[model samples]
Target: MKFFKTSLLLFSTLLILFSCRTEEIQIIDPPIENELAANSTVAKLMKNTVAKDGSKDNIIDKASCLSVKLPVTVTVNSKEITVNDEDGYEEIEDIFDLFDNDVDAIVISYPIEVILSDYTVKTVNSDEELQRLAENCTGENEADDDIECLDFYYPLKASVFNANLELILTITIEDDEQMHKLIEDLEDYSAVTIEFPFKVILNGDTYVYINNMQELEEALEAAKNSCDEDDDNDYNDDDCDKCSTEGIKKIFANCNEWSVEKLYLNEEYLTEEFKMFTFSFRENGSIKIDNNGDISEGIWEITGEGNEMSFSINIPDYPAFNGTWYLHEVKEDSGEVSVHLLLEGNHLRFKSQCSTVKDGLNAILLAEGSIWAVESYKNTGEDETAVFADYQIYFYSENVVKAKKDGAVIEGVWESLNDGSMLALNFSDEPVNAFNKEWEVAVMSETEVVLEANDKRLVIKRIN
Candidate 1:
């Protein structure tokens, strides 16, 4: 019958070419390493309970760029909770309106904080934001006023391979909207993908598509050198010489009862029986302050070593139970058994006071179109956080204090001590790296503000 009807049309075109070569484009080699993520999407952003703060609801939005650290704690129903501003501040403001519609999921926690940059190609001289960024770029310019963009800065972190995730950052590139969606590119796809949620794997034929702009700047310099590294380690796979600083001084040198969760003085906050006092720390520095079980008599030291050390104590006559400290960075995947403190310039804060723990601090809504950003300053804490990241400090309700960068806005005169205990910031000609002087307001919020001089401690954060 015509060769059995052409052998049934050649076995149906060889079964549709073997189902199109078994559906090609594979790509998902996820897990990004360091600790196998636990294996992908950073193990759905970390857990074992209480999403460590990337969101178990401290709040997540601003387009899921993410924001956290407010005494965090989760597990809403099976018990175990905490979200402070005084115990579940109205359920953390109704869980920031219940995750404000989860802005397209980008949950980030762990030590994985981010802000790396190499981006700097500015260009676009504004004509209504270059007609909305030239409808997605068609570069090599000729018209579209030489389009360029990709400025930088503003929350975008999570790609921690080789494990160290405990990195704090501040890599502003400028004019952002997450650098206008990583320098868009019309149909010009060349792989940029950092719409962060975590996933990386470059060498063994690393995928996620890339071709030109020099393989999209070598896949953004191999995902910013696998998400930043200069020994600020934490993308995990163990053995960073066992998380160095001589393994965090042999894991905090030993014998530390600590127990004083938090107890600030002028920066106020001495919670529940004033954080049930109990301070012990001896590997020979000799110190003990147990107030409730009475133990007092301190004298400790350890000045500058890895990560620029500083943790002094004296308690003889007590100057707010002796000062000098720095080591508040919690989470190395935080599995408690803690010892956190921060005095130098932040006045005070000590944690490790269990019994159903607690933590919360995020203030500095000092007012008047507030805008601060001098994160860290203990002498030259990174050149006063790079001269206040090019200045921008303003606070007034007639307490006056102003300093903007990029255009004359100088004006400073702030005072606070009448039992508000020291906070003086003056400025006549200003430019004295330390932002004029006087401080002691440890923690403030509306999003962050810590300060302390003479032992230097200055952390200010609130960029608009």
Candidate 2:
């Protein structure tokens, strides 16, 4: 009886040990590349659509070398849609909003018309001949009477991909009153043209036409101006437009259109000299945050119109943080613009907002207190210039100061006191950059200040 009882106890212990010793299941994380495969595929697919149907395909393959003469006004179905404002007044406002929000591209549709002016289609070897032809074709008397220049005509009706992936043809159609008859003629002409060893793709449908390359380029230029960004012109606000026309009529003669101007924070502030926290939008309609400032190229998304602009930015660094920005509230006829930004679940601040005038000029110079930064004087004293990685602080406005050193950030209110003609900075705490460490705003004249906690002696000159 004792032996049997011992055996039963031993058997139970072995069973328990076997159950406890089950193989450990490892939960390995997915590969980074694999995790983003779905999104990457979608982007590639979008590229394919544009490349396949658009001029990019031809550019890549080197098969059909067609250089589109820009600024060529096109008309579709007797509608005038686009114009060229050589001064960039038409596109500046949208451009600024685009940069501020971090948008790359969008699909917009519009009715268009193209006037088939005299042009020469040629190869790279015939560039000079083409130029000569263009020069010869200039002036009304030089235009060929045999070929109707006034009649918009399509040489090729549709584009088809060749075996080498080159665009075989760019579709064109006649801008004429008899488009119905023209379609019927095209159907029969192909039957005869095939015998002559020519194959043409037919443009059977029409919805939207790509804006003339020249016009699109011009628009981008206007946008670049609107953002008030000058890459090579850093530290010189000499030509910078501080304000943007949110929605104002820019008139040139009888032709008038509405445009907006925006301040480009990207260009105004030094990206390399200072660390910037970037926020962007996500595919899931949520804002993504990135602190590293890499992973995706930044894009600004601009929505709404006129004085009211809903701005959003997407940064490759901060994938999770995204939010909407707006102009500050103003009474009608006040002609005041207040820029405001809202990050998800975060308190709103002044740095996020920028104010502008009806003419798209920043209102700061005209404001009671304008927060501006000028060129810095070269430090002669034995001191280290502010180190960005180890320690930094961002003083955006009189009320907000964010200080950071060694990967930690502290935020609080701040103030600047006036001593005679100079301005002195006083923070809520000793800034991470150090208080006694001196800095100067290099204006036209010399101004110096010895900074201390809650007190400073400053000499400054204002240049408008």
Candidate 3:
């Protein structure tokens, strides 16, 4: 009986050892690539997305891979200025514009701090030290490590799991810094699965939905070097990164009564002739032009994609405006929409007067007790602003204008024509008569109204 009991005990121990080995095999069976391993390609791409972008401050430092810390003192064109923030860069630009003939230079004060691409901050005591650091950066507009065309949407939840696929903990990633740290802290025995159906923005305007890790990886790889990073020191060179064909189509189809605000053909301005016409674009690729009760029909189409979009219009009556013009920019400011098109030396801008924008401008113009003073005026390319220095103009809701000077008032009939694109004034008085005619509303705001005619420009500012 003792020998039989020993044999049974040994068999039971072997059974237990076999069970332990099976479980160990299961734990180590998961492939490292399936998890958020430290050396995984996905992890590396995520790190690149979160890496610090020092090119934003290239305007001040003239370095693409480094940024000067804020509140640094610098001499801009012999004028000492303290750059407190990004707005200070514009101030420096203004100083640089003060004189165009002179050489522009910026001298940085010593002992200033700079941030590297990896977000490392270091203090440089002299110009030589800063130059040495800048020498390590990529050349202007050259290829760089950081991916500028793609960005992950924030507040993403990551589901963490152990090697056995058991839920460990969930992490919330808010911004780039949090994401960077999360990817950096990934362990070999753990897996991080980003919750599916997350969004990423491409070129700051296009939205892409990612369903799984594979899609995310593919998107990151595709967008790594898909655009111009704008790493050059020319801050004013606006890249149309956000411009897309679909966006331009939506803007054109949605808004009616688009008037030509500016039109140039081979360096000749032709805006005055098109002032009387209003354009309407249809989604079915049809266009209608209304010229003071006269209607003309045409077909329009947009070709290409993204920033390479081109607009082609064939208006049989107006051949000058017909061309496959490159879409330069589409901008909206304070309810106003403007589309800029360029081809060779030709430039055209279409300003839309949507109902909301027109109503807003009319409200500002007809506001009770509002008075506008002539800030500047030009007649036939000659400055005649001083003639109306004492005049204060008022607009009534009933399309009546009254110019008061020295307690004497001159009545004039006024109208907002071309869907608020033009301001027509019929003042018979001598000084204010110079403002008569259909003036294009080049700019309209709460505090100012700028009108332009053929060789005549007028600027009026609101006083009260």
Best-matching candidate per TM-score: 3
Sort order, lDDT high to low: 3, 1, 2
Global lDDT scores for all candidate models: 0.40, 0.28, 0.75
Candidates 1 and 2: which is better by TM-score?
1
lDDT of 3: 0.75
Residue-level lDDT of model 3, residues 1-464, one tens digit each, is 01112245643543442221122222233233445556678789878877877777777777888899889899988889899987687557645644448888988888899988777799989988888999998888887778888988877876545546655445567778767766765653256566666778777544566766788889999989888788888855653567766767767755766999878786578999998899998889999999999999998998777578889989998998999988766666545677777777577778975534455567779887899999999887788888999999999988899999999999998987755667899987887887889987766778888787877889999999
On TM-score, who's better, 2 or 3? 3
Q: How well does each candidate superpose onto the true structure, as a TM-score?
A: 0.23, 0.17, 0.47
Of candidates 2 and 1, the better by lDDT: 1
Tell me how many clashing residue pairs each candidate has: 21, 41, 0
lDDT of 1 at 2: 11
The candidates, ranked best first by TM-score, are: 3, 1, 2
Output the lDDT of residue 289, model 1: 79
Residue 340 in candidate 3, Cα distance off native in Å: 14
**Candidate 1 lDDT tens digits, 109-211:** 2322221122223333333433343334322211221112111122433211111222211122223333332232111221212333222233211223222
Model 3 is weakest, by summed lDDT over 10 consecutive residues, at: 18-27
Q: What is the C-alpha RMSD of each candidate to the true structure, in Å?
A: 23.5, 30.2, 25.2
How far residue 91's Cα lies from its native spot in candidate 2, in Å, is: 6.9
Q: For model 2, how big is the CA root-mean-square deviation?
A: 30.2
